[model samples]
Target: MNGGDGPSSYARNSAYQRGAIEAAGALLREEIHKRLDLANHTRSSFTIADFGCSSGPNTLLAIDIIIQALLHKFSSSTADVKTPEFQVFLNDLSHSDFNALFALLPPQSQRPYFVAGVPGSFYGNLFPKASLNLAHSSCALNWLSDLPPELTDTTSPAHNRGRIFYTGASAEVAQAYSCQFKKDIKSFLVARSRELAEDGLMALIVPGVPDGFLDSQASTGSEFDLVGSCCWAII
Candidate 1:
C-alpha cells in the first residue's frame, strides 16, 4: 500500500474499502449487540484491535463504527452499565505510514479512545492472551503473509517466471499462492483466538473470489496481474 495521503496513497484510493465497511455497519452493530458479552466483562477498559489497519481515514471510520455500536449496546441495555474506556490497537505492517495514520486521528480532546500503533504482520501473535474484547479487520485478510517459496525456486513446478502474482499464471503457481493464503489465514485465526477474550467477537470483511469462480473474472485479480506485468516489464 502506498504511504501518506498523496493522490495515489491508500488513504486517498480506498473508497471501495470504506464503502464495504460502511455497508456492513448495520450487521456489525447487530452482531455486537447480540453477541458481545457485556455482563461478564467487568474490566474498566474495552480493548479493540484492528488488524491490517493501513494508513488512514478508513481505519478511523471502521473504529468509529465499532465504538458507536458498543455505545448503542450499552445505551439500550435495561441494566445500568458504565461504559468502559476504549483502547484501540491500530495494526499494520512495520513500514506502513504510522505518521499519516496518526495525523488523521481526531484530536486528543475529541477522541473517544486511547489509540496505539501495533506494527507487525497480523499472521502471527500480536497481543497478549485473552486481552481483546473485540477484534475487527476489514478488507485486509486477503493479503498473504509472504509469497510461497516454491514460486521462486527454479526446480519447483510452481516457479512463476514471468508473473509476480498467481492470477493468469499456471495451475501450480495458483495452487502455491492458494496454499500460502490458507496457511496465513490459519495462523491469523489462531493468533486472534488466543488474543480475544472468551465471548469476544471478530468482524472480518475479506474480499476474495468465491469457490468455483475464476480469478480471471475478478477485477481485483486482474488489477494485481496488471501491476505484476508492469513490475515484470521494469525487471
Candidate 2:
C-alpha cells in the first residue's frame, strides 16, 4: 500500500476497500459478541491485532466497531462484568506511514485503547503466543509475500514478460502465482494461529473469485492490467 495521505496515496484511494470493511462490520460484531469467550479474558487488558493495517481512517473505523461490540457485550451480560483495558496493535509493512496513521487517531482524551504500531511482515510471528484476543484484517490477504520465482526467470516456462501480474498470462505463469499465494496464505494462518489466544476470534474480509471466473472478471485485475499497459507503453 502507498504511504501518506496525498490524493493518490492509499489512504485517499481506498474507498473500495473501505466499503468491503463496512459491509462486513455487522457480521464481525455479531460473531465477536456470540463467540468470544469472556471466561478466558481474565487479564487486565484485552489485545486486538489488526494485520495489514494501512494508513487510515478505515483501520480506525474497524477498530472502533470491534470495541463498540465488545462494550455492548459487557453491558448486556447478566453477571457483574469488569471491563478490561483495550490494547490495539496496528500492523503493516515497516515502510507504512505510521505518522499519518497516528495523526488520524482519536484525541488522546477520547481514545479508549492503548494503541501501538507494529511493523513487519505478517507471514512471520509478530507477537507472543496466545496473546491476541481478536485478530482482524480486511482486504489484505491477497498480497503474496514475494513474487513467484519463475516470473523473473526469462528462461523458465512460467516467466511473465511484458506484464506486471498474471492476469492474462499463460497457465504456467498463473500456476506459479497460485502456488506462491497458497504458501503465503498458509504462513499467515500459522503465524496468526500462534498469536491468538485459545478461543480467540478472527475476522477477515477477504476478496475472492467464483470458481470459473477469470482474473479479468474482477475489478482489481482490470485495474492492474491497465497499469501494466501504461508501463509497457512508456517503455
Candidate 3:
C-alpha cells in the first residue's frame, strides 16, 4: 500500500478508534525525554522530524501531544541553560494534504521553520546526515510498496494471485514475503541512520512479531532485525 492510501484507508476502516494515536505519541515523548535529558542539552539546539506523517486529524493530534510533552519537560529544568530552539519538520509524501495539517497547528505554538512534503518513499533518505536530534514514526512502516510478485505463478497449484499467504501457499512464498519485509526494513534503517545525530533518539512504533523471532533467523532476517538493534549499532 502507498502512503496516502494506507493511512486514509485505515482511518476510514477503523470505527472504534479513539484518540489513541495521540496518546501513544505522548507516551513516546515522555520516554524520550527520560532517556535523552533533552532539558540538559542547553548549549545547542535540538530538532525533530516525523516521517510518513499522513495528514488528518490523527496526525496533528499526535504531534500536538508530542510538542506539549517536550515543552513541559523543557520548562521544568532549573540548571543554567541555553534553551534549545526546536525545529519540528513534518514529512509525508508529496500527495498528502499538508494544507490541512498546517491549518490544524495551534496558533500560540512555535511553528516549524521547515515544512516539507518529501516525495517518493520514506525508505530512502529523507533528511540530511546527522540533521535530526529526535525522530518518530508510528504505525506506518509496515506498508510496503506492493506485495512480492515472484510468489505468484499460474502453473503452480499453490500460487494464489500475488499473495504470499494464500491457503495453499508453499514454504517458499512465506520465505519470499519475509525477504521483502526484511529489505524494506533495512532500507528504512539506512535512511533513518543518515538523518539521526550521534546519540540521537528514534522512537518507532510499528505492528510486528517479536524481536527474538527476528534475531533467531538472522541469516534470513538480518535486515528486519536491524530495527531492534538500531541503538546498539548507532550508539
Most lDDT-accurate candidate: 1
Task: Write the residue-wise lDDT of candidate 2 on 1-235 in tens digits.
Answer: 7778888899989998889988999998899889977765678888999999999789999999999998888778665558889999999999999999999998878988899999999999999999999999998898889988888899999999968888888999989989998999999999999999997889988888889898878777898899999999999
lDDT order of candidates, best first?
Answer: 1, 2, 3
Residue 103's lDDT within candidate 3 is 61
Name the lDDT value of residue 124 in candidate 1: 93
Which sections of candidate 1 miss by over 4 Å?
none
lDDT (Cα, tens digit) per residue for candidate 3, span 15-89: 322244654665676785687655436446678787777665465555556666666666765655654666777
Candidate 2: clashing pairs of residues: none
Off by over 4 Å in 2: none
lDDT of 2: 0.89
lDDT of each: 0.90, 0.89, 0.63
Q: Pick the candidate with the highest TM-score.
A: 2
Count of backbone clashes, every candidate in sequence:
0, 0, 0
Position 38, candidate 2: lDDT? 74
1-235: candidate 1 lDDT, tens digit per residue:
9998889999889999999999999999899999887778788899999999999799899999999999888778776568889999999999999999999888889988999999999999999999999999999998888878899999999999867777777899989988888898999999999999997999999997778988788988888888987897888
lDDT-better candidate, 2 vs 3: 2
Who is ahead in lDDT, 1 or 2? 1
